[model samples]
Target: MFGRDWTEKDQSVIEHHDYSYIVYKSFLKYLYTGVISLPMQELLELLDLAIVYCETKLERCCIQEIKRGISIQNIDFLRSIADKHKKEDLKIFCLCLESRNS
Candidate 1:
């Protein structure tokens, strides 16, 4: 954000203290190579970062990975995350999986 009225416009160095170094590095790698490699926890954080940065392609990739790792044990957790993030596709997928399992 180097444009007018941006927070980082007048700053020389921008800092993002939210994510860990590893997670941020992984996100940068994905940005450059279009490949994502991270554990489930970090992957979820990366999804949040993708959404924040408006990286739709990366966001979709994270969603796909999350779907692949979904299980009955974690369906409720995933549903809650989907609801929190307003990810309708993920919410619907969780609902379908729950219905099938039920």
Candidate 2:
């Protein structure tokens, strides 16, 4: 581990967060603290954090939130997230979910 303390001193995430940072931090935590509290957001970043980390569960949770409109406004981003998680079959499901609301 780096000499620097890995404590979560910063605000949970980057103000302009990206998929890479999310995955990198998730890796760091699993490697260090043995805890993985996924970030909660009013708006999920369009960048697919799970694709980068290859964490299907997290991707699912985030996309679900987006479809619920409790998160960001980026269908393409959600689609990519779904595709990355080997959930391409879910694209129709998600699209259907999205359409029902609108």
Candidate 3:
């Protein structure tokens, strides 16, 4: 993790930004406990955080979300994330979709 001092950020901005309270707590829990309960509604963002934290094991729990019941926009996001993370299975999934579309 890049050590920029996140604590000095203005409270109002932190509160209103895309980082929700629940996600914030989860991140803190991950920092302290190395474990977290994934709330269903926040799975996608949580997966992104997991990737950022190098928590690949935690990220796998939501891989199915990246693989199914998705809109094109989200599929694109997932593909980008997979590419960033070098997640081979996600790359294969996107490749299968590309082959289907062609």
lDDT of 2 at 99: 80
Question: Tens digit of lDDT per residue, candidate 3, span 1-102?
Answer: 124676645444434366667876777786687665665457667777777678767677567655764555466766776788788898788878877776
TM-score winner: 1
The lowest-lDDT stretch of 10 consecutive residues in candidate 3 is 8-17
Location of the lowest summed lDDT over 10 successive residues in candidate 2: 39-48
All candidates' lDDT scores?
Answer: 0.91, 0.53, 0.68
Which candidate wins on lDDT?
1
Clashes of each: 0, 0, 0
Better of 2 and 3 by lDDT: 3
Using Cα atoms with residue i matched to residue i, what is each candidate's TM-score against the true structure? 0.86, 0.36, 0.52
What value of lDDT does candidate 1 attain over all alpha carbons?
Answer: 0.91
1-102 in candidate 1: lDDT tens per residue? Answer: 899899899999899899988889999999889988888889889999989999999999999999998999888998898998899999999999999999
Model 1 clashing residue pairs (backbone): none
Ranking by lDDT: 1, 3, 2
User: After aligning candidate 3 to the native by TM-score, how far in Å is the CA of 42 from where it should be?
Assistant: 4.4
Q: Over the full model, what C-alpha lDDT does candidate 2 score relative to the true structure?
A: 0.53
lDDT by residue for model 2 (64-91), tens: 5555542236565566656765566556
